[model samples]
Target: MTAPAARSLVLDAQALSLLLRNDRQMITRIEAARRTGVPVLVSALTIVEAVYGKTDTARLHWVLSRLQVQEVTPADSITAVRLLHDAGDLHGHKYAIDALVAAMALRSPPPVLVLTSDRDDWRKLCGDRMQVKDV
Candidate 1:
């Protein structure tokens, strides 16, 4: 049998909420990721948003189980901080959490991609540099 393919994906809070609510687009992406065996990463920032109790712990675990959950680290934090302050390029929408997620994806093994609903923000900073499939 052939070995499973490896994949890396970044999930933002909105995407997480979509996943929790059984949104079709979110479900499709999740299925695609599962089919590709790509690891899905949920940023700590998402946890902050999820702290609102909108997410069920059981479902969260299910989401996490679909792929690896890479914790957002200080290095990720530093990248976010830099991007947020990079007023020269990032423009108005380069928020802290997006930077961290982008940084984390960039630092991950090459070929990682972000599955997000917010394309504008991802497009603004990543452009063609990142592997992004936006909704």
Candidate 2:
């Protein structure tokens, strides 16, 4: 028999970007991962990052409706700020948003895993404290 899914999966900005761009490899992998009941999660931050302007918004909404989305609230933002602190200086940009996302990946008894293509900035912030994969 096929092996059961042994991991959780959360989509970061890049993963959504890949899906938006219709990258065959990324789509295939994401599809298989979803088909197998992987606990996929996406943050509002990732959604905003993926959607971009007007045109992409429709597509983003359509995609989001079909996927599993986890909302990042004010409290989540606050906590993320503390966790993301000292990682780097978060200016007027999406730092708080990212922090909330990082927090989502660090949830309760069984935390969700993160799927990202960005191996530089955000990953450095969270590190091994988060179960993030480059896939």
Segments in model 1 whose C-alpha atoms lie over 4 Å from true places: 1-6, 87-94
lDDT of 2 by residue, 2-89 (tens): 4334466778888878777777887787788678777667877777777665436676677777677888777777678776676766
CA shift at 28, candidate 1, in angstroms? 2.7
Lowest lDDT block of 10, candidate 2: 105-114
RMSD of 1: 4.7
Candidate 1 per-residue lDDT over residues 1-135, each given as its tens digit:
732343576777777777877789788887888777676777767757544556678877776676566688888877766765653445334365677778777777656677776677776656655677664
lDDT of 1 at 109: 64
Off by over 4 Å in 2: 1-6, 54-58, 86-94, 108-111
TM-score of each: 0.75, 0.75
